[model samples]
Target: MQNQTETYMRRALELAKRGAGHVSPNPMVGCVIVKDGRIIGEGWHEYCGGLHAERNALKNCTEDPAGADLYVTLEPCCHWGRTPPCTDAILEKRIGRVFVGCLDANPLVAGKGAQILRDAGIPVETGICEDECRRLNEVFFHYITNKTPYVVLKYAMTLDGKIAAYTGDSRWVTGEAARRHVHETRAQLSGIMVGVGTVLTDDPLLTCRIEGGRNPYRIICDSHARTPLDCQLIRTAHEIDTVIAVTEWNERAAALKKAGAHLVLCQAKNDKVDLTDLMHQLGAHGLDSILLEGGAELAFAALEAGIVHKVQAYIAPKLIGGAAAKTPLGGTGFAKMADAMPLKNVTVTPLGEDFLIEGVL
Candidate 1:
């Protein structure tokens, strides 16, 4: 029974990953129902405000769902949104046993889903293949627990740890493969954010150049009036949508609004923009995960605030040795080694000539 449960859990995790970008406001959930040691049905949540995992699984079932054992990647949602509570659906299906991979972290659903099933006189088991399930929905879990979006820090740098050469002429530091990977990352996120410094220096379009999915929201963090009006990011409306975040005191916010950019005025802390408040605002706007594409100062601020949850470094094999050539975050560096953040479960992969390193914060 344990091995069968593991197999179903693994399959559910695979399906959940496929629904990453599409499932927003709703955590990606996968479900499978088996009876008499035979697989009966399988389903995954495909989009926001859609049928939940249990309902999809039941829909796929050809035979009577009664007495079946249901296995779900995450705890079934208990609250009503666009769809009915999944706990009620499970009860109505008369599933004899339920095996949940991980508990839903949303305050509204957390333990309530499991409790609902239990109260319905159905057998309930949770935390099956727990680690894998939690990892699959890390973004959702982070948001629910921390009240902020999970920040994925992504950047490209040379072997010598430089993002650009001495002159900051960093048109393209990484190879085609790494750049394409960045696009893929952008596509997965609800939004991609950069500092005004990066806008001034690179004037990047900041859109998903990749082919798979829709472009994410492009966000720029500018405080004290740094982003220039003539920046290409403002001029182009090609593939992506753009939003500019400025402090309430910035006189340039109105101009940016006039230029057809979504402007968010947030509070500043210690002369720097308050990223925490910015993240909550994005969350309220239904963005659960954000990719922080950097220039150093923004990355450092996010890192210092303990808001960055993942870091992806694309390391190219070249040396541009100098203080000026070093990577952006390395500029001011961490204030102290004690302040240096630690990451766990680091994974490194090679993407063409560059290396992709990712880890949890």
Candidate 2:
């Protein structure tokens, strides 16, 4: 039974992966229903504002789901939102047994969803294939439980560990395929954050220029009010909403606001702004996930604070041997190798000229 449960849970994870770019604001969920020790039906959440995993599985089952065993990759959502509460739906279906991979970390649904099922007399088992399940929704879980954004440290560096030429003229490091892949990633996240260094150096618009999907929030971490008002990211309001994080008493706060920027004032630490606090502020504003596009220092801070949950890197097939040229994160690497907390489970795959790495805390 344990092996069967593992197999089914893995399938559910694969289902969740299928809808990666399409589901936002809604965590991708996968579910399976088994009866008499046999798989009966399976389904995954298709998109935002759509039916959840439990409902999708129930609809797929031809038999009466009453007394059947239901297995889900994530905790059944109990809150009332775009769709009905999944816990109630499971009760109505008369599922007698429930196996969950991980608890939903959203403060509103965390333990309450599981409790609701127990109250209805459904036998519940949790933590089966737990690590894999969390890996599937790492971004969502990290934001909800940690009160910080999930950081994906994306960088294109040479095999010798240099991100750009000595002159810092890294106009395009990775192939076109990889660059396009980055755009797809931008479309999936709720927000894409970078430091002022990236804004001043790259002057990136930071919008999704891929074939489909809406643009994500453009966030800039400007500690000393260095980002210029005329930067492409700030000027392109129609393409994406932009947010600037500044020190609590920054004099440029009003100027940034006058330039039509949403400014978040946060406490400073070590003469730099605290990214974790800024992330919490974004969460309060309803941001569920964020992608950290690098300037190095911000990425290092996110990792140092134990806030980065995943990393995606595009390795270009060249070798620029300058030690001063930045690596993935900007400043001195992680304080110590021990300071880097190990992800419970990690999965890596090749995506054209890049590599896709997903991990969980």
lDDT of 1 by residue, 58-166 (tens): 9999788899999899998888888989888888889999999988888888889999889888888899999888888888888777766788998888888888888
What does the lDDT read for residue 13 in candidate 2? Answer: 85
lDDT for 56 in candidate 2 is 92
Clashes of each: 0, 2
Q: What's model 2's TM-score? A: 0.82
TM-score of each: 0.91, 0.82
**On residues 1-361, what C-alpha lDDT tens digit does candidate 2 reach at each position?**
7998888888888877766766766688899998887778888898888888889999999788889999899999899989989998899989989999999888889879999899888888999899778867877776667655666767777767678888897867777888888888887788998889988888998888877666888888887778887889777754568888888645677777777788888889887888778878988887877888878888888888766767776777677787577777656765678976676456666666655555555
Candidate maximizing lDDT: 1
Candidate 1 RMSD computed on C-alpha atoms after optimal superposition onto the true structure = 2.3
- Clash pairs of candidate 2? 296-329, 296-330
Q: How many Å off is the CA of 225 in candidate 1?
A: 3.5
